[model samples]
Target: MVLSAVLLFGASSVTSLNGVFAQDSVDEISESVGDTVDNAASDISDAVTDEESESTTQEHGEMVHDDEGRLPGNIKIEREPTYKVGDDVQINATHMPGMEGAEGTVIAAFDTTAYEISYTPTDDSEPIENHRWIVQEEIAEAADQEDADAPFEVGDEVTVEAYHMPGMEGATATIDAVNETTVYLVDYIDTESGEEVINHKWVTEDELATLDGAEETAPATSESTTESSEDESESEESSSDEESGSESDSTPEENSDEESSEESTPEESSSQDSSSEETE
Candidate 1:
């Protein structure tokens, strides 16, 4: 009977141990399925994020607008783009953030045809005039030019109908302003201390930030020219007046001498007449 009881206890213990092992296996299977589901959800989330990013980038029409026309930090510089090509138009908007006040040169104007060109800006140690900005498009060039007989001014906006940038052409950009003056295609070094910006990109007008009073100095020199001209005119007038005075003074002396000579002649004749009478 004792041997039988011991055998029974051992058999029960073995069965329980096996049952526990089977339970652990089932638990592991359940855990693995949960992990798989979690992984799938994570992958789906990642895909959604990627799609959103793509959608965002696909927007070529969306403008990053600043109502005050303030420039974003990404923009390194801003200036009025001289319309070296387009006809005169009103500046209606700003490009590249902080460019609302940027002046553009009207290279050409079209009645309904949008003027566009490609340029690579030689900036940032890279030859990149590739920055082509549409000067005018979808607007009456004649009408706009008639409006501003002088030059391009601020508050004008224009759309691009050409392909300068990926979607730049035909993509509308505002005319920051219109400026009529000498636009310079120039090369220069940046004044900013250490940007390593060998050739920076920015279209400037006649009246942006004055470096060493460049524009002002020109006017000052012009004023000096005017003053010199005026002085020359005055000197000429004074010379004429002096000549006239000298002529007048000199004529009086000559006339007086002539009168004295005539009077003396008369007196001498009279003296001769009196002597002849006395002798008679």
Candidate 2:
């Protein structure tokens, strides 16, 4: 009986130990799974955060590039440009946001040869395409050369001297197009933000249109003349009505006096007849 009791006690202790071991294993596995899930979630969150940060940085860089408003110094001015200063225009350039289809006023005009260029930015940003209106003087090589009058051909690689945006100056660029047209500096209100943009440089003639329905003043002058004529006619009619009213009033008084005189003449005739009858 003592041997059987001892054997039962050892068996119970081993079962308890096994149960503890199994529970510990389960706990370790659960802890490990929880840690792995947490690590995965942290990694995904970090990746999403990094992507958002990169996107925001890129957008901010672009906005900085687009909002550069400083004017280039010593640019050649165009004499007798088709669009003069203070003339209202419609812009069709998509170089900046809210620039396309915006109404603008011409502030300055230049006669230089404008070039459309493509370039890789110096700040390792995305490549710019067909940037408009870099003049002959804005090219480092061309400005240094004796023949500054010579324009760059399409696909010709040249160094930029204009700092229209960040990373533009001192960067190498390829000319995509050339134009001898007038380039204008303009002021406009942004279509999206309603903010005033002043001294915006380098919109070409083809990208601008005269304000729709603009005219020199023939129609306006004619309308004013017609209004004045109507006013004069109305005043003449009023004066004539007053004069006619006064004349009508005076004529009635004259008729009454004439009737009185005629009545007096009939009384005189009856008196003469009575005097002649008395004499007879």
Candidate 3:
């Protein structure tokens, strides 16, 4: 009986230890799963935050870097530009967001061969399309060429020396178009962000219009003139109507006077006849 009791006690102790071990294993597994879930959530949150930051930067027109970026050290200046320095003008460029149709003041002017180029950025970003106003001096190959006036033809590949935007420098770019004209540095308020942008380089002469000559301004002026003309026409019609009304009123008054004279004549004739009869 003693031997049997000792055996039973030993088996119960083993079962209890096994239950404890099983419970510990379950707890350890739960902790590991919880840590994995927390780490995954953190990673997802970070990715979302990064994407939002990039979107905000794009929305606010933050791509342009002005003189803080690379610029051509030895660009030729235009001695006489159609739009002189200090001239307030309208920008017609779509190089960046809010650049088109923005009011700008000319800061400097240059006579150069401007190029529109297409390139893949060094940052592995999306390929840029028809980026405007990269001057001949900003192209490494063109600057080393014998003829500075001879611009690269469309589809010609060249090395970009400009840092107008991130990843622009040292990237291989293809010329899309070329223009031999005056380029201007301008200060303008960004239409998207309402922020002042200073010393923005390379707005071509053809891409600028006088403040008063802007397409929007022209339409507004024309609309005002047409409104003024309509007002004058309305005034003239109103005056004509008044004059016609006065003439019509005078005709009625004249007819009334004639009728009264006719009535008085008859009465006067009758009175004369009665006086003659009385004398008789």
Candidate 4:
């Protein structure tokens, strides 16, 4: 009876110890799972914040293209485009501020080499990266002796002669891309300022969409240019009239001075004669 009692007590003790170790392992696993869930939630929250920050930062800067008047190189259009020159189209490209969804007039259309370049602005602003649409004509030759028509490949460093952007006229840029396509020069109203922009250069064909029954609203020479020429002519005429008036006003003063001089000479001669007669 004593041996059986001892065996029973040992079995009970072993079972109790086993239960305690099993409970401890379950608690540890639960703690580990809770910590993993909390870390995963924290990581997701951080990722969402980073995405929002990146999106918010994109709105602060502007990407601008050349707006100088188009210069045609000896390039020919290989295919018919959906929109031709003089067609009024809506611009979908937002390269510059206030450009997206604006009405644009297609002033020029040609096939040429368009380049993506990086340059420092002449105004001493921050260096612009991957700027679009500096055409082949806009790049200056490195050497006067070299051929001006030489094609530039990606990574060729060259000086820009184009005044499309501030500080772009003289800065050296590296070519990033070379594309051969139909480029259009356009005129558009600025959406933000409600100001008219005319003869703005170099929106590619892909950037524009034709309106239904679009007529030739854009002229060969923009009306803005015609008005500008007239204003300049009027200014020149005004300047010429002012110059003629100044000459006329000075003429009377010159004549009065001459008359007074002539009268004084006669008076002096008579005085001398009277003195001689008195002496006689």
Candidate 5:
């Protein structure tokens, strides 16, 4: 009986040992599998993060036109009391965003009065329906100065060169008007919050500089240069129109040659026509 008891106890101990070893092996495999899953998840997360970063970078990289086609900087509008067309001057009006102290090399200086105008935003969900700025009737080339944002009516597309709202900068905006009264850098207080908005706005020609350059008088030579440029532009336009007419009419010499050849070779024309039909 004692021997029988010893045998029973030994068998039970063996079974307990086998159970512990099987459980340990299963635990080890589960731990390794968990580690692998974690590593895979981390790699996927990192890849997603990298892709998002690259996409954001590319979106901000390519900005060509400024909010107003002017170069980057805060530009001030300067008014010359005696301004006119083809005047050389710098803008000193604190009307340009980021250009209060910055200098503007005149792209075109005018003497007539300037006015700030408005336009409806083209971008979806943009807040500015009619943004106000400057237009001078003297400088505006459009047919009407009072029509708000002439380009809006005329369908001239324009990209944004300035920003009135965050993310509005670098976003392509449409041109609404080409000509108007004086433009201004405006400081409008939001009725709800009283925040300052610095929109580099456009005004009339009179709103700009007459003699905005370094306050020094230009020599009479400048007048001659301006006149010459105007003449050249007129000449260019005329030349362009002539070229278009010539192209539309066929080269005059080529047409004459064609007529002469047609008279000489009516048989050849018929033969060629027959050949084309055969090929078809």
Candidate 6:
């Protein structure tokens, strides 16, 4: 009886130890799974925050030309503009890539409301902040809204119809500031790409300067000189041809007179010979 009791106690102790180890393993596995889930959730939250932050960062496309025509006719120049239409000026501002140091031709100028805005893109991508120079006419009013001519104040939310950059149109934007200065539409060559950018919008007077010694100015002057030289060359050629024609036409008459004089000399010589023979 004693032996059997001892054997039973040993078997019971082993089973208890096995149960404790199994419970510990289960607890450790549960803790590892919890940690993994927490980490995954944190990573997802961080990614979302990062995406939202990136959306608001100011980024633009290389080309943003839609809504780039003239401003409204009602918008007049409030003061004399520093640069006039058809003036070639150097760009001092870099509103887009490759704008600074580029040569621009002024196409239009008008004094109207300009705005700095922050907006979410229409495609629901990242938001853009502090975008410059979206004009008053570029904002699309809500259908029910009144007061079309009123300028927007800071913190006012409006929909942008201007495609100042890609995904900018139809975006809801908050006005950050307003300016009542003359804005110019211009054509410029991309110094980097050498491509022509036409009817670029909203460059303020402060952003332009006289194009003294700019890269394009030198080439234009050289071309003008080449044209002038060509004209002079053509004129000289024409004058020389006229002079040659006159000399040739006069040469024929002189030759005919010389031939007549030679024939008369021969006749005089024959008469002298006949007189000499009669004398002999």
Clash number for every model?
Answer: 51, 0, 0, 3, 61, 3
Clashing pairs in 6: 55-126, 55-127, 56-127
Candidate 1 accuracy as lDDT: 0.44
Question: lDDT per residue, candidate 2, 27-115, as tens digits?
Answer: 99999999999999999999999999999766644443445455555567888998999999888988777788889899888878889
Which scores higher on TM-score, 3 or 5?
A: 3
lDDT, candidate 1, 11-121, per-residue tens = 999999999999999999999999999999999999999998887544321322112322112221214333334322223233333333333334322221112233222
Cα lDDT of model 4 by residue, 114-153, tens digit? 7888877777878988877777777766335276545689
lDDT of 5 by residue, 1-280 (tens): 9999999999999999999999999999999999999999999999999999887544433211123444223222446523432334344444333333333323333232332333333454434434434333212243344652333433443444344333444344344544434333322322323333323344344334544343544655688889999999999999999999989888878989988888979888899999999999
Ranking by TM-score: 2, 3, 6, 4, 1, 5
TM-score of each model, in listed order: 0.32, 0.57, 0.57, 0.47, 0.29, 0.49
Rank all candidate structures by their lDDT, best first, as comma-separated numbers: 3, 2, 6, 4, 5, 1
- Please list the residue runs of candidate 1 whose C-alpha ends up more than 4 Å from where it truly belongs after superposition: 1-94, 97-161, 167-212, 237-241, 264-280
| Candidate 4 residue 89 C-alpha distance from true site, Å | 0.7
In the order shown, the candidates' Cα RMSDs to the true structure are 14.4, 9.3, 12.6, 18.4, 27.6, 9.9
Preferred candidate (lDDT higher): 1 or 2: 2
lDDT values, one for every candidate:
0.44, 0.84, 0.86, 0.76, 0.48, 0.80
What value does the lDDT take at residue 235 in candidate 6? 100
TM-score, cand. 1 vs. native: 0.32
Question: Per-residue lDDT tens digits of candidate 6, residues 146-169?
Answer: 866578789999988876567777
